[model samples]
Target: MSVLMSAFATLVGGLADLLQPLFHAGSAAAAIILFTACVRLAVHPLSRAAARGQKARTKLAPQIAELRKKHGKDPERMQKALMELHAKENVSPLAGCLPSLAQIPAFFLMYHLFSSREIGGEPNELLGHSLFAAPLGHRWADALTGDGVFTGAGLVYVALFAIVAAVATFSFRMTKRQMAAAPTPAAPEGPDGRPLPGMGAMAKVMPLMSFGTLLTVAVVPLAAGLYMVTSTTWAAVERYFLYREMWAAGAAPKASGAARGAGGAEAA
Candidate 1:
């Protein structure tokens, strides 16, 4: 863990050194943003794959619904049919999760890289840096409690909070739009053909994840907060462009013959 964090901090410090001319001492914050952008770009191929997979699943949702209708009574058979359908379409249930899963390690590394007082077994000088008036190493809690809420440093934290909130709002809207477009899962139905209990509730709650993100920003070191804001904002915009490009080009997978045959047989 120490070796990996040492390497990670080295990379960030190197980037900070590179950008020092432009930002002066504030370059540490800018470096975190740039490093995050590089990470985002590096993981983009996985993001593209995940996007393609999600779009394919959306395209195949109807056939999946049919399979569920046919095999609804037997959980084992339904699972088997679902797997067969996915195999035919060349999709994985986990495809949409690939980029996110891939990013977890790096994300935690950045968090620790900024949050720690030591790196490479030495006192971390990077923490001495500040962005605007806010110290990169200072948590929002520290700024509020120590500096008082109206002080310059405390206000800097507030401004960061605001930026994060705005990004979170935009993210929430985009997520809600996508969820609205998603075909409802082919699960057991409740009265009046309604979706089963908790489905609607789950949909409503998912958008609030953005607020959860805001909560994270409120406690983390300013450097990590900067990372969160930059990465999430990048993710929202990246997903938008990728989804449009893939959809405009008609890249979503079409149902294979086996899936169509199964659905047709059930229909008849």
Candidate 2:
């Protein structure tokens, strides 16, 4: 555990130190966005898994409904049936978690990279040096952009932070709605198949999480914050839409991504 933790720390410190330079121009917000994007881009496997889960879920909805009707009270049989169905279909059962689950590590890495102090005096994993020099601060700064969102930025930034907070509650609803709005190809399913990683209560909490994430980005350098803003908007868009394209690809989706696609990709 210590080694893993140390390695994790290294990954993070390396990211922050490396990318710290990119904050020179635009703002650390920009670098943050870049870092977010780079991380997101690398998480294609999780994205693929999530899309697969989504496809499988849409395909399995009817079966799930039937299972609920037939075995709603028989927990053991329901479990057995569900497992059998999933096994037959080659489903991961938890596959819909691809996008969301993928993001945890990236978030940790971001925190690590964003918060690390001068490790080796080398620019860690970050790409460029600071243009205006927004010296790094606390980890919370990374989470909220180091207090970047002042009241006067715009109704947009103001609204964005609120939206990010409410994203768990509201934005994801729109996302899910959009996802449902777009038709997908059929998939095989288990008898009790529903969307893998159903977004029930989680839906309500996501916007809060989104808000927290954006807030984290807001406190950092303007560049990082700006990147956060752009990436957040982009991510919300992609989360709603990317499934269609990724589903077409087999196990690993290509790296094509929007700003948030790359940035938010890791947050998947």
**Candidate with best TM-score:** 1
Quote the lDDT for 217 in model 1: 79
TM-score of 2: 0.54
- Against the true structure, whose lDDT is highest? 1
In model 1, which regions exceed 4 Å deviation?
A: 186-200, 244-268
Clashing pairs in 1: none
Cα lDDT of candidate 1 equals 0.78
lDDT of 1 by residue, 113-224 (tens): 8788888779998988898778888888888778777796888877767887887787787676566555655343332233567776676787878777678778877888
The whole-model C-alpha lDDT of candidate 2 against the native structure comes to: 0.52
C-alpha lDDT of residue 81 in model 2: 79
* TM-score list, all predictions: 0.83, 0.54
List per-prediction Cα lDDT, in the order shown.
0.78, 0.52
How many collisions per candidate? Answer: 0, 55
* Cα misplacement distance, residue 213 of candidate 2 (Å): 2.7
User: Distance from true position, residue 229, model 1, in Å?
Assistant: 0.7
Candidate 2 per-residue lDDT, tens place, 42-115, comes to: 76567666667667756765676677678877767877877877777777767666656666665554444444
